[model samples]
Target: MLNRRQLITSLALSATVLALPAPGLAQPAPTTRIVVPFAAGGPIDVTARILAEAVKGTLGTVIVENRPGAGGNIGVGAVAKAAPDGLTLGIATTASHGINPWLFSKLPYDPAKDFAAVTQMLRVPNVLVMNADAAQRLNINSLADLITYAKANPAKLNYGSGGTGSAGHLAGEMFKNQAGIFALHIPYNGGNPAQLGLLSGQVDFNFDNLATAAPNIRSGKLKALAVTTTQRAAAMPDVPAISDTLPGFEIDTWWGLVVPAGTPVETVRKLNAAFTEALRSPEVKARFATLMAEPAPSTPEQFDAFMARERTKYERVVKLSGAKVD
Candidate 1:
């Protein structure tokens, strides 16, 4: 039905259309990946997964890659060494960002220099708890009484922790230093066994993670004396903070998001905005509560300052405790 000139023009138009990509065949959106420097099924990994889902609209398809090993050095170090693009990010834990630099003689990454902080994700408060029977037997109803008893009865009390360099062990050391008392430290294989040891009366007290110890505390098996955070944890407002008695005494496990150092300020701001917003969302808060973690979002500057203070504090505590990576 077409004349020769019309047919030639139609053929040229069809050829041009064929040269361009169709809508469906256009390039797929790029994905952003966050590396969780811990094993899967853990709270850090869960947090990363939650953020990944929450930021899908802003960040496209976000992927969570778990690269856990060597006290989280393997994965976190990778992040430190990664390209400074916002595409690759990592979760920095208390051990990874706060303690590892001092614990290890040589570290793969410098906590202070290697990563740009996005924001503090959450803090899991470690609590000071005693066995119900032990507290009752010793008439230790309060932190003040515990400190007094520990002072009067030198080396008469003891505690258990997950391990020598764990948050619990360091908290115990801080307690001894600040309160001017002595309490024997028994380091179990892990937190569970340590909690079990406390439950079975193998150890008199422990600076235990609130999440694992909460049920026991509620069940009257363990008596919570104080939380290690400066402020009382939202999960347990009734319990007082140890800072109330021993000024400036604080210790806990925490984690946050970080990108490799040298990442552009704009990229860092984007990541901070996405994650901090996610942390503020109601659904995210609910999920964090399920893990007994309180969202402690902060600006990048605040996170950096906090990490510096933590590192300085832990340097003294770790040295005083005489704990080193094995």
Candidate 2:
């Protein structure tokens, strides 16, 4: 009954109306699982649990699952291959996201390509600690003293770390190369065992996480030589920076979140906003403080850039140390 032009207009309008979402459109409830690529009580694990608690209200129910193996590769690879529906996410670190690819001959997932950058969570210094008795025996109270002792003893001095390609190992190797010392490297399955090795005097020293090493350092069971940060850590104000002795020596482990690549931009933004807000919460702040980690926040883009820089830095360190995963 209508003219040709009117008929076409009516048909077009009907199609557009059909395409539009219904009024009061309901979005599916958010159910998120945060994957930590390390064992419980480790740096990445601690941070992930803190974030999980903080973001629970925002994400409906935030859960943390540990899938530790291959120096955090197993858990990270799981997230990389997960659905990009804002449900499964990963709490990534230098080992899982930056250092693993270059150190391993082949990685299960592409660090840069397989995941979406969420936000930089926190940064913690690497502490150089020695057994209480060993510290006294070697007369090593500071970085200078350690260097002097190492130079005199050469290969007699040894250190332990989490694993071959871990940040702690690379940091110790850098210290050895820069200071021109010949300290033996003793690699262990994890930081706890490495710390035990140091405590038992099986190893002369260890470059360990501030979170993991703080209690031992505080208890006077171990002597703090220095921290691997550009500036002295607020938690260990008396301890000097390693850079003080070895110029340009700065290696700090960092943690952040990443989602599967190709996730919707809106979802990424939502996650970034929620997580960043949670990072600023008072409870999380206190938790990080107790763990000797400096609470850090960054935009998604900033986190991406940080990861890139970390990858380059660790790549060079791995080459210098001749480090590879066993």
Best by TM-score: 1
lDDT per residue (tens digit) for residues 69-122 in model 2: 877889889998999998998987878777888898888899989989989999
Off by over 4 Å in 2: 1-28
What's the TM-score of each model vs. the native? 0.91, 0.87
lDDT (Cα, tens digit) per residue for candidate 1, span 190-302: 88999999999999999988998999999999999999999999999999999999988889889898999999999999989998999999999999898899998999999
Candidate no. 2 TM-score: 0.87
Q: How accurate is candidate 2 locally (lDDT)?
A: 0.88
Tell me the deviation in Å of residue 298 in model 2.
0.3
User: For each candidate, how many residue pairs have backbone atoms clashing (under 3 Å)?
Assistant: 0, 0
Task: Tell me how candidate 1 scores on lDDT.
Answer: 0.91
- RMSD to the true structure for each prediction, in A, is 4.1, 7.3
> Which stretch of 10 consecutive residues in model 1 shows the poorest summed lDDT?
23-32
